[model samples]
Target: MDTYRTGDEGRAAQETSFRAHIAIAKRYGKPLVIHDRDAHADVLRVLDDEGAPDTVVLHCFSGDADFAAECVRRGHLLSFAGTVTFANAVALRDAARVTPIKQMLVETDAPYLTPMPFRGRPNASYLIPLTVRHLAEATGADLDELCAAISATGDRVFGPW
Candidate 1:
């Protein structure tokens, strides 16, 4: 299941959608892929209030170091996307630097947020390597090591790598 919503909306809407997601997750027993734009704090509150599933992933995460640390502490997985390759993503790179390898994940958010070397073009899963390379550089891990770790994380979250 996917749950993407802004945390900056009125409290009522956030609560309603959050509850709806929780109910859906409970009924289906599927992982929730959450899209958090600029509402890290509010998103955290919602997760705390409703209690998160074992497979809660923060997709295309753009939060600060403190929020990343808190998410890690709470056992949520952080999935980086093509945005990590952007010049404005210094904070994201820093977050990747400090996050544990086991806790890190990667995605393309495909057809959007294409990584460097193809930023202006339409994206697909085949272009994952671009973002993968950037993630390796940011995290200071070798290509193979980073790839293996990312594969492992994918398996753990989405199942059957």
Candidate 2:
């Protein structure tokens, strides 16, 4: 399952939750999809301390280039949503560029974060192809190659479809 948890105001609670998530993911052997909003540093620190699972993805990655680099260094995958198609989402787009192709994935985040050309509309898995297309163009990856890469990444992280 895709898990999304926010960090609390205090670092202690945040760390606690982060550790708990690590434990839960390990226990279930489930892939983790972390939503790190305005808590990249703390999230990274907690991950460093507790370590990440075999398959961990930073969904809708909003951090800077350095954070993206760090995630890559730690063997964490980065997943981009429709926001990457926005004109104001330059940082997110740039992060996609710097991220290795094998380390990239795509999601529609259905019912939210709809990609360009479909903004304001309800989202669903059907919109994934649009986001993937944009990702391929942004990363200069061939459409077919990116599709295969995305599928492989998804399988590695989420397992067997």
Candidate 3:
């Protein structure tokens, strides 16, 4: 779930909806994939208030090392996207370093946040390797091991394919 700094009324409604979505995910026993843009504190606050789902994925996680550590502590998997491959994402790289391999995942955030060297181009799952390769380097993780761990995380989050 995501929300901007809309008016007070709008923010209230969005938070209500976010809470409902969390409830639904819990009821169905599915992972809640969050699209937190800049509302890290509000997202964490609401989740804490409503109780997060069993499996929560911080989709395209954009938080810094501190927030990443908090999420990891709460057992929420951090799924890095192409943004992590950007040259300016030093904090993101630090976040990845703190996140355990078992708690890390990867994504393309398709049609957006394309990895470097092709940043202006449209993104797709096919470009995931570029992001994955960058992530491996940034986190100082073996490429093969990172890939394997990400695959396992996929199964853990969404069940076997």
TM-score leader: 3
Ten residues in sequence with the least summed lDDT for candidate 2: 1-10
lDDT of 3 by residue, 100-122 (tens): 99999988888999998899899
After superposition, candidate 1 runs with Cα above 4 Å error: 1-11
| Counted clashes in each candidate structure | 0, 0, 0
Give the TM-score ranking, best first. Answer: 3, 2, 1
Query: TM-scores for all candidates?
Result: 0.87, 0.88, 0.94
RMSD of each: 2.9, 3.1, 1.4
lDDT: which is higher, 2 or 3? 3
Best model per lDDT: 3
**Candidate 1 lDDT, 1-161, residue by residue in tens:** 12344334465675678768866886788777777777687788878888887777888888877888898888878898888899988899888887787888888787888888788888789978888898888878898988888888888777884
Worst 10 residues of 3 by lDDT: 1-10
Off by over 4 Å in 2: 1-11
lDDT, residue 107, candidate 2: 83
Look at candidate 2 and give me any clashing residue pairs: none
Q: Model 1, 10: alpha-carbon shift in Å?
A: 5.6
Give model 2's TM-score versus the native structure: 0.88
